[model samples]
Target: MTPAVPRPASRPRLLVVSPNRSHLALLARRLGAEGYAIVTAADGATALGELRRSPIDLVLAELVMEPMSGPELTRAIREQLAFAEVPVMLIASRAEADPAVRAFEAGAEDVILKPFHFEVLVARIERRRAAAERVASMRADMKAMDARAAMKAIELGELKDRMYQLEAERRRVSA
Candidate 1:
């Protein structure tokens, strides 16, 4: 029998939110075909609910929606400590230059204008995902380093206490 091969880890999970159901479904299908695990929401409220339910690696939202727009959703996401670091990308039409600017101000990492190439969109998503992964890795490394530093500080304190005890004993014996 041939040896079993190891499977690669799961791809990133993406949350795609749009007011248009057909467009949302199309985007989900395309992204899914690209090997990303996708979750779609028809509006910001539903998207937030999904976010509260599970972890999402990235959020791609439409610029305009009822009640809550892409920038509004981004702000809400940023306000939540749990998802503050998740990268948010907004999709806007060519006419939405103003709102696109607002998206950046509201903490969107990237905004892709409509009538864009599929390849370009894919490239942008890949770049953002890579950056997010690097940030996460760095954070983990920093946490590990902090733990080591803390442990060393504790060791140093213990050693100093022992040294003080030894000095006191010597004084008592010498006396």
Candidate 2:
């Protein structure tokens, strides 16, 4: 019996943060062409600002940067209640340097090595989003079940009350 709550807009938005200028643009351009609403930032500070300002569905950041690194950004994002479900991926600049372990510790979904295929990035994004959507659907289903259970409890209480009244009436009639 609760009023309908207006849902947030469903647009898929991504924030790409990197101190490197070249590949950042490439990612932005390609991902934008792929129909993502892209937001770009040069560092984690700017990215955090953008996250606060808009509804970002995903984040792609460099593994290392100045003023705020990928791990810092991931930690900050995770600390916020609103961004808890948002997925973050960190891109490493060197093949020999794998930040996967540290990135995971910082709450990043994955660390992408340099020279990664754009297709792989897109696939990861798709999988993350699919999993998130599934979780959201499950939460809604749970809420409905909880409400139904509460209503059933109320009905059972009323039925028991009626039964008790019927027994009392029968006893009085017999007496």
Candidate 3:
């Protein structure tokens, strides 16, 4: 049998934020090997700053962190101007489902348990990223249209005022 042809991989820019140094290192290495350019942050504060300064396709945040937790970070990210639709996946070792639910409520697109299967995690991340991109693009277009409409309203108001002034001047001259 002929050897199976290997498919080329699409490298996605992913930000991996975790409070645990060892876990972060392992995740960064694994994801990087799987055709993802990994950016690491030790805490939510640093991750938020990095995300603002750079373009990130996806975010993987650990649920437990000092200073700020994953859900809190996700909320902050959602509040940002350009990143409202950016996909986020929260990671945690806790078996309880409440944290995951909380993360989703706080704006995380999904939650993955630690020691996650590689293929599953990658697939979920890719899907969320694509969906987020589509949503963000639509939102930007809508915002542009809203801005144009506001400008048109301002212009119409000015025109009406000008017409009234001209009518008043004509009446004064005729009288």
Candidate 4:
């Protein structure tokens, strides 16, 4: 067996789904070598099952597969709130525009054509990962901001109540 690639704890976990066994193996090996933890699924159903089983940072699926095409799988994933934010990249066996367009419409983050250079594929994956990280960071910042705003609103309300009480007390004392 080949030695496992040394990966950092923060490395993204990738789910690779393909009906073709060879294709799946190739992607798993190549991507694993690039320091990504890979989980393989032979079809869309298995892929969905894998998603439910564990957290996956990204999904790489073949464009065409039985039971569910890449676009169909993407739609299914998007329908689930937990998996909706996971970026999906589809691999097309041919340079057809229709399938690629469908993949995009279904919410895939990227679509790579077959015969692509390995370097390009890796680069695309890195780009997607980076984009996802940025989005997550922004979401965290928004949540924190919202929390602060809520606290401020509560504090303002308390201050207003105190002022009202003070005004009532002063009027009584004057009278």
lDDT of 2 by residue, 1-175 (tens): 1222333456589999999899789889888777788999999999999999998888999989898889999999999999988889998866545488779999998788888877787878878877877888898999999999999999999999999999999999999
lDDT of 1 by residue, 79-161 (tens): 99999999999999988658668999999999999988877887899899899999999999999999999999999999999
What root-mean-square deviation over C-alphas does model 1 reach? 4.7
Clashes of each: 0, 0, 0, 0
State the lDDT at 133 in candidate 3: 75
Off by over 4 Å in 1: 1-7
- Alpha carbon lDDT of each predicted model: 0.90, 0.86, 0.86, 0.92
- Compared to the true structure, candidate 1 yields what TM-score? 0.93
Lowest lDDT block of 10, candidate 1: 1-10
Which pairs of residues collide in model 1?
Answer: none
Of 3 and 4, which scores higher on TM-score?
4
Candidate 3 backbone collisions, by pair: none
Regions more than 4 Å wrong, model 2: 1-11, 95-98
By TM-score, the best candidate is 1
Q: Which wins on TM-score, candidate 2 or candidate 3?
A: 2
